[model samples]
Target chain A: MNDLMTRLELSALQDRYVSIIDNDRMEEWPTLFTEDCLYQIISKENEDLGLPAPIMHCDNARMLRDRVVALRNANIFEQPVYRHCLSGLEWTGDGADGYRCQTSYVVINTSAAGESTVFQAGRYLDHVVRTPDGLRFKSKRCVYDTSRVQTLLAYPI
Target chain B: MNDLMTRLELSALQDRYVSIIDNDRMEEWPTLFTEDCLYQIISKENEDLGLPAPIMHCDNARMLRDRVVALRNANIFEQPVYRHCLSGLEWTGDGADGYRCQTSYVVINTSAAGESTVFQAGRYLDHVVRTPDGLRFKSKRCVYDTSRVQTLLAYPI
Candidate 1:
């Protein structure tokens, strides 16, 4: 793909990724990534030490499925409603296998009681690849701004 | 500072910041920022549109002070305990005023009974300025990987 087309494709992939989370479809959310991909939810606190343990680190597709199962059956956070408003989608680089993109945005979370709050604010560091199925995530590292979270995180952002 | 030095400093800042939270010293956490700082607890869900209101948006010292006040007197969540494990501190950019740092890690929440689980896993997007006291936050945005948060985000992240 040309540079512009690659950028557009990457932007759409980012959008669709967030949309899956916003819609609370945890089961389908993990399918956006490659099967052997490394999915991590990391914090600045843990990442500084070169740690491999994410709050939820899934190195394979089976582990990702387990997370979805846990979210659906075991976790007990408040019923969540999410709205993703993304902007500033910037194309950072391109490679033989895929493209790199950096985008910044705010994610707002509203509860069942109608109280709205800012759940987290940060950008998506995305590594997207062109596959036979179209564009998919080879890796996605979600880096958050707050080292201290308010409570439990039940769904994927 | 050189890139490596800047990364080290940013890592130290994140470590210190997490220590304040882990110690349950909410009063001192905001002091890590400058008087004209912008502190926001946002989610990746709403970051793209730039319209999502922060769970806590303190534009200046006074507003930040009010947040501390509210945490002390008005708000209520679990008497939760946070253990922040930060890692992967990278210096993304450097400028005349400050440097932009990105780090990732996991935040674990433990109740008084020793029952613990992952509270949040996210990244810290911080703009650290060279204040008279040291590196202080000009803008700190906390973005979580999961948009479905627990009950209420009454406490600072």
Candidate 2:
């Protein structure tokens, strides 16, 4: 694909990924990632020391699926509606298998109690590829700015 | 500096940043940013739509200070002990003014009852520069994997 087409494809892929999370379709979320994906959600406090212990670290697609199951069955937390706003979509470069894209995003949470808040804020560092069907994620790193979160995070950002 | 040196220095800077947060040294945290720094704590929910509203969006150093002040004086939430563990440092590149680094992290929150839980899991997308005194943050973005936060996030992550 040409550069412009590639960028557009990657951008669309990112949008689709965000939609999956926003819609709370946890089951389909893991399919976006490659088989050997490294999915992590980190806090700034832990990122500096080079720690491997993620709130949820999945080395493969199966692990990611297990996380979704756990979230559905084990975790108990308030359910908040999420709206994803992403911009600053800059295409870094093309890798051997996929392209790298760095984008800035803001996620707002609105509770059923009619309280709207900014729950967690961060960006999506995505490694995406052009598959036969469409663009899919090879890896996704959701890097957050909050060193201290209010409580447990239950849904995928 | 060589790649190894750069890695070590960046790692140290990341550690210091987290220490400042954990120690409740909020006053000093803002100074780590450059004059025209961009600080944002956004959630993935907001990233899909390309929005610019962060829980805390401080374009300059002074605004960051204001946030620290407000968080200290105005917010109320459970007082929990936050312990940060960071790892998996990857140096993406060297920009004109600083180095671009990404790291994974997990933050454990200990309650007054000594019950510890996984507060957040995410990564840090950082821009680190060498000031006259030491390395400082140009921009730090923390993105969480989970969108549904437990309570109120009044403090910086």
Which number leads on TM-score?
1
Tens-place lDDT per residue, model 2, B3-27, is 5456667767878888988887889
Candidate 1 lDDT by residue in tens digits, A1-157: 3665566556556655765665566788778888877777777566777776577567777777888898889867665665554667776655676777777755665555444456776666777787888888787776666677666866666
Chain B TM, every candidate: 0.89, 0.87
Q: What is the TM-score of chain B in candidate 1?
A: 0.89
Candidate 2 docks at the CAPRI level of incorrect
What DockQ do the predictions score, one after another?
Answer: 0.02, 0.02
Q: What is the C-alpha local distance difference test score of each model? A: 0.70, 0.70
Question: Where does model 1 exceed 4 Å of error?
Answer: A1-157
| Model 2, global lDDT | 0.70
Q: Please give me the DockQ of candidate 2 compared with the native complex.
A: 0.02
